[model samples]
Target chain A: MWELIRANKRNSIVLMVIMASVLLVLGFVIGMVFFGQEGGFFGLMIATTIWLVLTLISFSSGDQILLSASRAQPITHEVHPQLFNVVEEMKIAAGLPAMPKIYIINDPAPNAFATGRNPQNASVAVTAGLLARLNRDELQGVIAHEISHIVHRDILFVTLAGIMLGSIVLLSQVFLRGMFYSSMGGSRRRYSSGGKGGGQAQIVMLVIAIIAAILAPIMAQLLYFALSRRREYLADAGAARLTRYPEGLASALEKIAGDPSPQLATVNKVTAPMYIVNPFKKAKQIKLSNLTSTHPPISERIKILRNLSQGASFNEYSDAYANVTHKKTIVPVAALSTKEDVPLRQASAEAGSEERLDKQMRQVGDIIRRVNQFIFLTCACGLKLKIPPNYKSNKINCPRCNKSLDIPRK
Target chain B: MGTSILIVFLILVGIPLLLILFVIGIYNALVRLRNQVDNAWSQIDVQLKRRHDLIPNLVETAKGYMKHERGTFEAITQARSQAMGAKTVSEAAKAEGALGEALSKFMLVVENYPDLKANQNFLAVQEELTGTENKIAFARQSYNDQVLFFNNKIQMFPSNIIAGMFGFTKRDFFEIEVAAEREVPKVSFS
Candidate 1:
């Protein structure tokens, strides 16, 4: 997994550089055409600044923003103990240094994603629907898949790609709209039109500028979709290798893909690719050949995961994928060489009971209460003291016994 | 003349700076690898502590129902104390192996007693102890992996030179030595 993660970092760097260079080139072209010769340098400067700022902000605090925006409350073992245990198990499987923080959204939509700059700073968020819907092995499978994403450094690339792609689309819209306003004025054209040879060149540049502006964001987006689809396949393979139970993830993918509610209240296009299946539940028949969407078809991903009964290795994934899609080269050759094959395990398909799930949900509620600054203390007389996180006291007296309990002063 | 000056500038200034940067990067990475090995060892420590804490409760829960199983209970206590005293990884492995053998024998004896098996408290403790055992095995595997990676870094070519310079020595792996658990749980990458 470490070797695979190193390889992933290399690929992410190469892709990010490619995306940023494209953005810079577009900026240069647009600037030069609009403001004569000097705007090219200014354009590069502006684009570099935007790229730097976006990457810096996202690198530092993007995970928090993503979690908070989705109304995901941070949870601990005391509250959502089973989820913590599962995360711990996956951490051991993925060989992560520590368990990534866990969060739960109150919404009933069944979606989950991993986010952060790296494994240490990473977080995994799941909706209430996800907890209520999937069984234990299925839940483990989803977690392993998310852990794979963190181990592979996919989160950083996704965040950086999103920033660059967003900047390009925004800039393109600004330029296209500027062209509209300038054309309506029609006064600036006469000044440039005074020089005969220069006038013709300017008109050609304007036409090319308009064409480039219209095409650049679309081109960037297509590249992004291309990048994430391959990473998703790799993450699935990584998840299988970690859990040694491909069918667990395979069946979970089936449940998620088959789920009726596809829309998440907090999801947008930028964070959609981070999800196991595309959150747009409406796109039922997303195909590998389709160039429009960020994720490959859910049915195909499930088929490939189910095919891993043969073995868990990059080569086996390629073979299984080939069996289903009749196409090879799903995993890159460099990654294939570093991949280790693990022996297959027979399916142990025990599902969790509803009683257990109810307990787990109640635990999640207690965790949310704790996260919201609610203080809980136990007394010798079998009574509980409930106080807020910001209760502002160094000590609290137990209501039943009236004995003082020490509170860590912040 | 301008190209010749640039070449001289690169050789005289650029080379030393690059060399210094390379040394710093390799040194930092080696330190990071060593720290990861330490952290993985601590995870194993945490799991072992959990197992140790659960053993007393397990014995206490089963004591009343199994009067004839007094010998097995004593053996478990002896093994537990031995494991607690075991200081090194290899020593701990041997101690743990003996403990596992005793515990498995104890479990086999447990099958004859219907009252102990039916006790709700005994069942919960047994479930928890089994979970702890699984966690302990995983933690050991994780530790060995980290140690192996750390060992590789210190022995490999270019970085080994820096490792030697920085005194980063190779660490021992956590191997499960008992035949019972070892037979089923071997690390078979082949």
Candidate 2:
């Protein structure tokens, strides 16, 4: 595991350096286009400053931003004891230093994500529908996958890389839009006002700058997607190893992918990659776009997970991945070298009857209502009333018995 | 003469210093692994304590509807006490396995009492008991994993020499001794 983290850290640094250089070069060329040769250094300085500021913001409160963006409410252990216990179990299994704070999104989509700068400060957020749908073993599988992301330090890497990609995209968009609106003839005339030789060089620089602005974001995105896809595989392997049950994750992935619910309401392109399953309904249907996706195909991920037959070790996951994908191993060699024979454990006994499903659904609804400050009133006629916090009336008559009841005060 | 003296000094002091530093590095790593093993063991202890605390509530809840099942109650109580009194990892492992077996038997007998199954208190206790059991199992799994890593480090090459010098020893795994644990519970449908 340490080897995996170290390798991830190294690769992240290399990718960041490549991204930083791309940002700087793009800035330099754009600067040259706008202010002739002298503006190159000025543009480089601006790019560096922008990168630093964005990095600062993400490192300090990126998790908070993401949690709020998803409309996730902080949940105590009482809101869902089983969920807390499962997260605790995964924390032990992964040997994380502290428990990641738990949150519940109001959305009905069955998806989850982990976010923090590091494991110690991490938080795991799951949608309300996930809690209502998955059984204990399946829930553990999902939490274990998110915990694995925290353990592997993937959150930090993805945050840094995502910021870089955002900066590059933002810069290119601004430059392209500015070029579109402004006249190209003005820049050409402005360059010719300098000197003939310098004017020709400036024109060449402007063309190169336009081309760089066009291609830089694409190249950066491809790099980011390549690394992110590999990290997903590694996190999957880590999840299997941590939970010691590959089938749980496999089934959970299938359920989440096969869910017919609408896409998560708050999910945008920036936060889409953070989810366990791609939140975009369109990504799964298009095979060609899968290459540029931050995550590997759901079917491929599920297949790799199901192929882990022998045990839940890095080596086993690597073998299963190779068998399923017919590709090179994603797990680091050092991680695979640890010959810990982690035998898979039996699934926790759970009854998945229809009655149990209804009960689970009710429990999840109650939990969400509780978080939303809903007041519960039980009538003498056996009717349960759920009053929203914003209810204007102090008393309400039961629909069943027409008996007025005062709302319980906190 | 001066150059030769410098060469002699380099060979004598530089090499031994490097060796000591190397030994120190290995020793520190071994110590870290040892501490991790100790930490993992404490995690198991915590889950075991939780299991012990929940068993009485479980028995108390079941005692109401299971009037004729005195033997199952006594078996669970006895196993719980034994597990609590256990002094070492292997001892705790054996005691906990016995407790687990007794609890499973009690649950099987619970099937005969529909009233007890329907009681909300019993159901809550059962949920907590099962969650604690899963936690204990996961904790034990990780404990054993840490023990394996520590034991391997103390027994494997290069580090073994440092381990010997520092008196590092192998730790026992929390193994399940009850043969019944490995057996699948029979589900009979009449």
DockQ of each: 0.22, 0.69
Which ranges in model 2 have alpha carbons more than 4 Å from their true place? A184-189, A283-287, A392-397, A402-406, B1-12, B65-68, B112-121, B185-190
Report lDDT (CA) for all predictions.
0.79, 0.87
TM-score of chain B of 2: 0.85
Give iRMSD, candidate 1. Answer: 2.7
Q: Per-residue lDDT of A5-31 in model 2, one digit per residue for the tens?
A: 889888889999999999999999888
lDDT tens digits, residue span A215-282, model 1: 88888888888889989999898888777789889888887877776478887777788888788766
Question: What is residue A199's positional error in candidate 1, in angstroms?
Answer: 3.8
Put down candidate 1 lDDT per residue, B14-107, tens digits, no spaces. 9999998998999998888788788877877887788788889999998998888889999999999999999977888799889878887888
Q: Which ranges in model 1 have alpha carbons more than 4 Å from their true place? A: A1-3, A186-197, A284-289, A338-341, A344-410, B1-39, B55-79, B87-91, B94-134, B144-190
* TM-score of every prediction relative to native: 0.75, 0.94
